[model samples]
Target: MSDSTVEDFLKSYNPEVRQLVLKTRAVVLAVIPDAIEQVDSPSKIIAYGFGLKYADLICAIAPYKSYVNLIFSQAAQLPDPRGLLTGTGKRARHVKIKTATDIESPGVRSLLEAAVASMTH
Candidate 1:
């Protein structure tokens, strides 16, 4: 349990989903270089944020059976000029990533930047 890593969690998913998960992780990390990663195997989520605890969760990359979800915790507060985010929750919102290309979308990058800025400020 103590040795569990993000790689281990990602391995449980199918190949296509796994690839999307890896790409999504890369995008998030690239945007927030100092973020702390937390792997919650039971929930099948890999969360990236700014602090040592889950409370600081900025975003999470979750792989489903068909697609991957990029969940932004402070999404409601972030600007979504392109209307990319989808969720009716009080705070959380997400963008579905069907391929590696989706992770590199300008809208996704903008959302990622806003999410990180929300946490830092």
Candidate 2:
């Protein structure tokens, strides 16, 4: 069996959704410069973490047919005064990205930063 890569994973998404995912990925990488990114082809997710463990996971760029979601593992714990997160999950929440502008939304960077700090600190 061949190992799936981020490129291979993203290739399945549509062009517009691919751009949004790439933009979201750039923001995540910019916020967490040293983060290690892992790809899950089956889940259609590109996860970023400080280390190779479930607990170390900070966020994931999950792509769908029409949009992408920036999934945060610590969303419930993060102080999101801007209310950018949306999810009913007890431990995780996600911000939907329908456009590149959504990825650059005011609260997105802050949330990403907090997610990184939550695990590193």
Candidate 3:
């Protein structure tokens, strides 16, 4: 789906989640200006594309009551040289953040960059 589609989906989500989704989108935009947002997924996930070549290597964000979830579609493929992320679920992996403060960590920035690299050219 296109960015507008993604925004619409988020708009329909629970208010708490919707707010976090907006914040997450802002975070992604700050880092990757050219990234595209798409909500046209049957899986209920939002994707941020780094470029056409790396479109699938996404920064996926979802929300919960207590905290927001930021997922790296290619987390399994990232170097993880610093072991900053932790998740063992099938299909995808993620780094959970209890507060927006967590997003400011240097490690998170590196992870974001690596996530983008893992997907596209």
- Which is the leading candidate under lDDT? 2
| Model 3 per-residue lDDT tens digits across residues 34-115 | 7776664566666677543443547777666666678886677777666767788654677776766777677777888777
Could you tally the backbone clashes for each prediction? 0, 0, 1
Tally clashes: model 3.
1
84 Cα displacement, candidate 1 (Å): 0.7
lDDT over C-alpha atoms for residue 44 of model 2 = 71
Evaluate residue 116 in candidate 1 and report its C-alpha lDDT on the 0 to 100 scale. Answer: 82
lDDT of candidate 2 at residue 108, scale 0 to 100: 95
Which portions of model 2 miss their true places by more than 4 Å?
A: 1-4
**Candidate lDDT (C-alpha), each:** 0.86, 0.87, 0.69
Candidate 1 lDDT tens digits, 2-97: 224766887767899988887888788888888888888788888888775767999998889989999998799999999999989999999999
Q: What is the C-alpha RMSD of each candidate to the true structure, in Å?
A: 2.2, 2.7, 3.4
Q: Write the per-residue lDDT of candidate 2 for residues 24-45, one digit (tens) a residue.
A: 9889988988888888777778
TM agreement with the true structure for every prediction: 0.92, 0.93, 0.71
**Full candidate order by TM-score, most accurate first:** 2, 1, 3
Candidate 2 lDDT (Cα, 0 to 1): 0.87
